[model samples]
Target chain A: MTLTWDMQDAKSTDDRDVVLEVKDLRVHYATPLGDVIACNGISFKVYEGETVGLVGESGCGKTTTAMGVLRLVQPPGRIVEGEVLLDGVDVLSLNEEELRRVRWNQISLIPQGAMNSLNPVMRVKDQIGDAIQTHESRAREAVKERILELLNLVGLPARVYNMYPHELSGGMKQRVCIAMAIALNPSLVIADEFTSALDVIVQRVVAQTMLDVKDRLGMSMILIGHDMGLQAQLVDRIAVMYAGNIVEIAPVEDIFEESLHPYTQLLIESIPSIKERKPLKVTEGLTHDLRNPPPGCIFQFRCPYVMEHCREVEPPLRELKPLHEVACHLFEEQDGKIVDISDESVV
Target chain B: MRGLTPGYLIRRLGMFVLTVWLGATLIFIIPRLAPSDPVAAMVSRLLAQSGSVEGSAEMIEAWRARFGLDAPPLIQYLRYMRNMLTFNLGYSLTSFPSEVEDMVVRALPWTLGVLSIATVVSFVLGNTVGALLAWRRTPGLVRTLLPLSFTFTAIPFFMLGILLIYIFAFGLDWFPVSGAYGRALTHNWNWEFVKSVIHHGTLPALSIVVTSMGFWGLGMRGMMITTDGEDYMILAQAKGLHPRRIFWLYGVRNALLPQFTALALNLGLIAGGSVLVEYIFAYPGMGYLLYQGIVNTDYTLIQGIVFIMIMGTALGVLMIDLLYPFIDPRITYETR
Candidate 1:
């Protein structure tokens, strides 16, 4: 049986269901020196059948944020405090049994490295079947048929059912992971750098498979990656993270067209183009130490329009426009127009 | 065989034969290089027993011809290889008229029974202990107590055997001091004899298992830790499979691959038994036979036992090589 959601029915932001809501989520990695703030009080929401791209540079806690939301952060990293409410259920407060039942059934993960994400010794069917079988028991024949169907859903051949993970190509392995994540049709799927290891051609194929599977299943997704171009093409909205904090988040077009945060501006400028050769725009500041962040806006040191007040007060994430939020002190909404309020000398 | 190509199987078996041949040739040459003649040594012993012997030179010459010592070294080497091919180890030097193979046959069962059981028990117990040691969910008391089990690994097995014999055999009188079975019982498959055999075999087997299990446990612990950190391990946890399933299937299954190769090599040593442990217990196994052969300088007996051990080891490696692809689908001999 096919489950379809009418795209036209829930067009309004108010009418759409919030499938996932991550609020004040903080994850820390323990060390002898101190705790490294990996995901520093990050918050976001994914509406029903919406894809929110969490894009950032390497080590900016995009994966950690997803892990924290899924309650899969490994030690010496732990979710210190916050709420990860999936479908209005408080995931952090659930007992072990309850948490397990929720995982992969309500929210599955297509991990960062698809090549290594699968158990090498197990066959493809078994790996896909494991996710399905863990939450519910079914007849062996039915499980086999369902696994074959899942392989087909991801555009993989039926022969892949009997093959081990190593037998499949990288793209095929990625599709297997995608199929596995959507096996139970979880409401939300977290794809963490899912296409990073693949070549450009394979990346496109795997990305297409993910989009196809996601559309057919109509699941909410948090696609965590660093590919600005890919994010622009695939996601409805984009969240730009820096130094363990989301510097800016908006509809993809708004993010690309009129980005508010300074870091987002630099990120857009850095996207390589094939048409012309331009000097690379390299922002000239290292990220502050994660264990001890500076007491202000995280991007203050790198922002071109840094002000005296920006160094002392941590800029809160504020909604300055419809469905657009930015964490910066440079601009303010005046009569529905974002006006540059920074000191002229600093600009 | 299912995973192995005919070419790979032939190559592997060929390698096994080459190993046995090399071992046999080395043993033959090394003993010859020592400059001690077995016949001369036997004659000297006889001379020491008697004040004078009539025509001892002539007797020596006749015996040398009879034993084929008169042949050139090259001829002797060829004959030795030919005999090895057919498993035709000659008569023991000290214990004349007894065929080396017959004695080995008599001792083989005891060694295989005791050591094989010990090897398997130690491997299983050690790996289980190791997996538990590395497992995050293991109970507090178990984690504390598991290291104590490895304490015996630090001591040599024979020394542990001595300690066991002193405590359980001598002090408590719970079992016999030495031998493979009770003196009163006849060798049979009946319960009383079997029980007695187990009783007698306990300390020797216990010494081996207790001492060697720590090595296995430590290796397994290291592998389990590495396997636990693999990317699939995190995905397995995220899959929300029960902790037990993850521990055994995802964790232990992958961790156990290297250990299987180790177990194969260890199984090769079974034909030799623990030379010292068997000596200490006076158990009638290959180790005890080897000890007697060394003491008496019975070249044929020593050669026969060593050859059996070499064959056993080569056979073990071959079996593992052929079977590896079946256990781990990733390993394929078809490529080789």
Candidate 2:
């Protein structure tokens, strides 16, 4: 539940400050059956001017976690426990008026589906201008100039401002989305699968633009995606989530080279690379049903090296190395039994 | 860009021709096949007026033959189609000197005016209310009002029209009981006439509004509910868009697309008019003209009214279709 980052180093070394720090965040959806624990006690820190990669499988609660951070959860899904501290302010505790000020000013989000995300009736420029005008009491000319600047920053021409969402290409639309997200120079940007819908080439362009904007604006980001390769390319640090829990938190290099958790190890190994033609190693079984999760480790059902004790008790995230934490029974004991299996048995 | 493909234009023209042919056939055949003799009805009306059967059966048969009622159903249908294509809707039996097209021209504008105004009023008010309800975290009073509005929508337009007439006309005496204008104003286009027209029109307009607004509100509310959950709406909120801006621009704007299509459809019906509303208000519109046509079995007048209604609907749909690309460039015939 505790997240400790070198704040002094992060502030002094980087132009971007520590924008958002989520501690022991727990979000659950109340369903007819019962409460489905979507995000169960997760913690991470996003420093200013850096992109933190949140990589997980489809049902690993990545999107839910993002929505919870924004407090945009619809009825039945609520943030049960969490401290979403944005620039030292607890976003969860703010009143509507205070939260309204904080939301678009401190943090902005680039949603997953760029294609049908825009209002079909409105011009692209107007949509961006709308964002600016809503947050700030600016003159029309100033807002228009800012919108054009944002559009240009995202590699869109000034002409696109007059065009409706449907007129723009997928890449253009995504850029418009990015422009919208960065309109107010928000301290932190949460892009939930923003580039997942684009082709690889477009995805790369969008991802690069995001990084470029972050660098220029000095805004922090949480880039959520399932592609490990994409995450490795964009994010400075990676938090690999598995079944509502962050099993591994480390720098990009450590996650790939010295992955401690079995889930993180499996994820790293599964990334298709040019150097190796080995078949991808995938984690076995589906994500555990959150409504009635087993008493022990949620990943125990899918873990290849699950022991008898693993099914009886849960494992706490313990620091395996400097700035690297892993939550798994394999790393729980000093001399835990080590078992090696090929890709066939694991799958 | 050519705006329309050649194939699309050809297909549309072909459909238009087919629709007209079908309409002509149905109008001609259904009346003939109604298991009642129009000649007998005409004869009965003459007898009722004269209080005696002065003409011979042969004379009555000759009159029927002159009108082409003596022909077989299929032949009659084909003849009607030919006349329709040539813009010759023939003479009204009830009003012999007046052509069907003339009667339609006289009555069409009134219907169009009433229904068009009603349609526009309902769309704007309903959508605005629905969007507010969807977006605002308003108090219980506003929330309670929404269900009542929905209840108004559930009632048929005719029932609502009657209710409005009772309350506003009979009970309150605030508006005229019937007709488009007061007798005192008498065809004048002055302020007095305008005021009287507005007064009389209120109950009818209210009837249309109360009946139809609910559908639009419900539609807009539902659309907002779904659209509000969309990622972009959340993105807008995260962008620190003021709550009102988020609702109107992000939430309602996107939600209005489908409602626009529905509104377009309703606009098509404006020329046709609300038959029940017209009857209740005794409004001199195409709806009442249609009523007279049916009651008198005025074949030519009915055909003319039907043709005009068809053309109005076709043109409305076409206009809406043409406007789609301008509104949302992603939409196109090719995409479908």
Top DockQ prediction, candidate number: 1
The DockQ figures for the candidates are 0.81, 0.50
Model 2 chain B poorest 10 in a row by lDDT: B327-336
RMSD of 1: 4.1
Write out fnat for all predictions, comma-separated.
0.78, 0.69
Give Cα distance to truth, residue B326, candidate 1, Å: 0.7
Candidate 2 lDDT, tens digit per residue, A1-347?
Answer: 33233432333344555678888899899989899998998887787677889998888889988988888876778999889999999999999889888876788888889897787777887788877777798999999999999988988899998987877889899999999888898888889899988999998898889878877887788999999988888888899898788888888998888677778878877778898699867667877788888988888878887888789988777654555667776653233322223322221
In the range A138-165, model 1's lDDT, one tens digit per residue, is 9989999999999999999999999999
User: Which stretches in model 1 have alpha-carbon errors above 4 Å?
Assistant: A1-13, A343-347
Show pairs that collide, candidate 1: none
User: What is model 2's C-alpha RMSD?
Assistant: 5.0
Q: After superposition, how far is residue B275 of candidate 1 from its true place, in Å?
A: 0.7
* Model 1 per-residue lDDT tens digits across residues B55-148: 8888889889988889999999999999989889988888889999889999999999999999999999999999999998899999999999
Task: List where candidate 2 sits over 4 angstroms from the true fold.
Answer: A1-17, A137-148, A157-159, A279-286, A305-314, A329-347, B1-40, B51-91, B95-106, B132-140, B164-168, B332-336
